[model samples]
Target: MPDLNIPVKILGIGRYLPERRVSNEELARLCGRSAHWIEERNGVRERRYKSFETNAFMGARAAENALADADVGLNDIDLILNASGTAQQSIPDNAVFIQRELGERAAGTAAMTLHATCLSFLAGFDLAASLLLARRYRTILLISSDIASVALNPEEAESFSLFGDGAAAVVLSLAEGESSGLHRAAFKTFSEGAELTTVRGGGTQFHPNAKMTRAEDNLFHMDGLAVLRLVRRHAQDFLEGLEPGLSAGLGAINLVIPHQASKVGLRSLERYNWPREKIVETLSFLGNCISASLPLTLYEAIKSGRLERGDRFLMVGTGAGLSMGGLILTY
Candidate 1:
């Protein structure tokens, strides 16, 4: 990567979790394992499961909250960007549905989708920054909504117990000055490990309605150990590649908000000597919410006052592409 130094800022952020809370005990019954086994395996005690909340509904709600937090209205948004791992449907993009769910005020707003699995938000943040810098869009609404529970494989206790459903949104705009913006953005995908985590169906390769598609084809699958191994192999070099001396410590970084991949995934940072106190985590309660995990964790950090304006923080994570991404920014 190169020095982006994009002058973009997160104007507001918000998250929306489903009303239903699924506890590990409940999941154990479905997976035929003990609650303790689920917890020990994934470090998730409880995760939200959607009842009737469609992806668009959840996303719109979160976007409304974000707009409120930013002190802006729907009509003020210049673009609507949907960065989600899962789509509400196959034909139309998810962003348009989110725009529709936002009601008439969002009519005619440019909408599209950009997905990088779990790194969707990070990638979107990078793109949004460039757009703002180029003066293409003044105020961008970025939303991530994932309904992981729908695709979970009950037979796979580990992955089944590791994911949850949620939505998160952020409003981005140009920073008034050079004070708050992105300092660095880097992403790399290891295509060799792409098959390690995926839902092999619902695409052109494995159409959901195709007679050849098996029930398992539509379910989420993961070779947890393999994914971890690949990440471990490249995480160090990748971090240092993002910014020199980053592997040793955060240096001037005030906080680190990582994707809530899992209990072990978040804890893996300790191996690089990153301080635990500096990392923000919401996995225990939220589980791995796909792309929403990163921004949702960021939302929690701001709400808790751990991350405040003028503070520099690093957002980094691994996603389904067997990809690792990092963005360093000042809040």
Candidate 2:
């Protein structure tokens, strides 16, 4: 028999959301469009918003809960990894602020930030698993958080209806013996489509000049048609590539967690012939939270008893940079 054991197991999971909730009708009015038009195009009903806090603060709330659920004290955590597209300030990194809020003992914890856009959390999972397997740490906290609402342009209907603010966290620990956990992880990218989805300004490519408008400086942009095509192709490719490594048959996989981009993106998976009962979506409630969406959806699935031990999960993520990744977990 294949050795279907994982060296690291999830100890706990948690999520945090902001106070403000913007419904589709409200957003449509702000954009001078009909709510039906927005819903037909993006399938977003509402999204959360944050007014006066940084991503680190939002992320820490979820991390604190995960640590509490795991029954692990701050001193017991050996590493902290933040996967966020939005950091309060670019310098010192969000991980430093998280470490500071976690206290002096936590300040000493090995911490770093991963910047893989929406797929950052999946990347963090791979890194944490590798470290645990290497005996580098006993307990690790992984946080996926972003506040895309901060970058929204009131003029952009596509963005305002989709992106949201939220955070999700998971605690992973090295397993002493055979235990259920992360089975396999893989990632791939296609930069050819990078321009199809991105923020146009603020990076090295386009430094702000006098001609640059506020819309260009602050808004998220995307070639919706292009992204739709690329995601459908890659989602299928990723799932097919991962099928062989899964110990359970396709029907046995318990949950399929995907980024909360749009209903269109989520519906594209239906063509893959995967079991319909396995998919869990939070798009209707949370909107697209970028890096935090997938994990937050998974956290909700677990909390609602939609997931359980011995169940298999397949997580797929894609974001700007035209990047894509997938991971298989046995829990």
Candidate 3:
């Protein structure tokens, strides 16, 4: 069994939304669909988009909010983690840039990045639990942000209408309490889903330098049907793997703050007998912000009072690796 005794607690959470909010009507015009058609399909009325903000820039903004909310001074941060799917640039990671923008006190602080696509936040949380418990760092700042709209294919309404731009951050600190920190965590990946959701360009596999590189290769693509099928097959096993962590079982989970992958993506939990009301959702407004979805939805849940401190909640997500992961914890 994995270590289920980590004592790190979430101090604060914050998110930053782009200035522009694209409504379904605006999106329908692009794809030649009716507003009602879009809404009925994705359950997304609108979503934000990054007009000029860079990924790292938006992440810095969200980090400031979380740090202030946590009542933590910049000097108190021991490490900065940029846990997102996309990078501001391919060269230097976004961690140091965020730390620098955060404030001078954040200067000289150790910085790094963890990439797990949409599961970035949960992956960071799982890693932080182990690292914090080991005393490797006193206070850690993890930020997840994505601007997926730029790369979306306009013709692919199913994918484009479901993606948005946003950022979310969380502050984690060591604390003493059985119900205040992570109790259990698990993740599963299926390489068979490698092509289900992909952006084939920008990497060595489809490098610009390569003669065969196509413009479509650089844009985001998704085999939505394949993704749904794959998840349906694995959903049960994923839940079963997580059952050992809960004090009770699925019903004992106060809330399931899931990734806002889609309308169907969230509803898919119904098959596992999860209560609809117990599932926290931000997809209708925020759509899918890649790595930012979970953290942003989590921020919404707490702000809306759907979740409370000491409440055992499960954070779950499915992403690019055809990966599935979850953390059973008390917020």
lDDT of each prediction vs. the true structure? Answer: 0.93, 0.81, 0.87
Candidate 1: tens digits of C-alpha lDDT, residues 1-331: 5777788888899889999999998989899999999989898999999999999999999999999999999899999999999987987888989999999999999999999999999999999999999999999999999999999998999999999999999999998765898989999999999799989998888997788999999999999999999999999899999999898888999999999998888889988789999999899999999999999999999999999999999999999878999999999
- Write candidate 3's Cα lDDT for 1-331 as tens digits: 4648677888988899999999998988898788898888889999999998988889999998998889998789887888999976777777867776777777899999999999999999888878888899999999998989888887888887888999999999888755687877889999999988899998888898899999999889999888999998887777777775232347667898989988888887776767788988889988899999999999999989999988888898898969999888888
lDDT value, candidate 1, whole model = 0.93
Task: Flag clash pairs in model 3.
Answer: none
- lDDT value, candidate 2, whole model: 0.81
> Quick one: best TM-score, which candidate?
1
Say which candidate scores most in lDDT: 1
User: Which residue runs does candidate 2 get wrong by more than 4 Å?
Assistant: 1-5, 208-215, 245-249
Indicate the residue-level lDDT of 275 in model 2. Answer: 58
* All candidates in order of lDDT, best leading: 1, 3, 2
- Name the weakest run of 10 consecutive residues (lDDT summed) in model 1: 1-10
Can you tell me which runs of candidate 3 are displaced by over 4 Å? 1-3, 244-249
